[model samples]
Target: MLTIGTKAPLFAAESTKGRIDLQTLIGKKKLVLIFYPGDETPICTKQLCAIRDRYSDLEAADAVVIGINPADLTSHQAFSGKFGYDFPLIADEDQAIRKAYKVGKILGFLFQQRIVYVIDKQGTIVYAKKGNPPVTELLQVVNQNP
Candidate 1:
């Protein structure tokens, strides 16, 4: 897990919204990177839907939300369309981003762990937590930096 104040690992990948370059987003918007195991699963769906439901709050804080999963672009597109999510869902097909963040599975599990990282405008990681962190907590963090 990446500690607070550490520089976030930069990545550029295809997403539902378009090509996303983490470096470009830095110094522009506070970012919330949602790393999950797969698309359309129960927990992952719930977690993303929660973000969808409160997306405006995230935007109000001048934050950009991006979800990363090992699923392909087609899967991510389908899932995002089904949920009407406006944010980008990145397809980490080769798991490079997952490996970069050290968000691999527990024990011998095949899926990545559910992790959330909040990065500030300067490319510094402000928060890193495993599992589904509350939307309120994330909003508070975003609002604080804005």
Candidate 2:
């Protein structure tokens, strides 16, 4: 996992909202980057759904929440539509973003490890954790860093 206070690796990838370059949002918004295993899976869905439930709070804190996985755009679209998630879901089809972040695999490479990173407005990571963390905890980190 990327450590706290490290500069986030920048990347441009196709998302549900089209192409997004992390560098562009560096000074504009704090980032909540959720790296999950797959789309519409049990735990992944629950994790993203939690974020969706509190998305307004995240927005109010001046954050841009993005979910990433190796799932393609079509899979992402269907998942997002089914869940009514307003945030962009990146289709890391080639796993380039995952590799850049050093997110490892689990269960003999069957799935990517779930990780979450909170990047402040200046593009430095403020929080990095494994598994599903509560949204309140994320909000707390964002509020503290800001």
Best by TM-score: 2
Which digits, one per residue and each the tens of the lDDT, describe model 2 over residues 1-146?
A: 89998999999999998898998999999999999999989999999999999999999999999999998899999999999999999998889899989999998998889999999999999999999999999999988877
- TM-score quality measure for candidate 1: 0.97
Off by over 4 Å in 2: none
In angstroms, how far off is 59's CA in candidate 2? 0.2
* lDDT at 121, model 1: 96
Error of 1 at 70 (Å): 0.7
lDDT of each: 0.94, 0.94
lDDT per residue (tens digit) for residues 1-146 in model 1 = 88899999999999999999998989999999999988989999999999999999999999999999889999999999999999999999899999898887864777899999999999999999999998999999998875
Q: Which 10-residue window in model 2 sums to the lowest lDDT?
A: 92-101
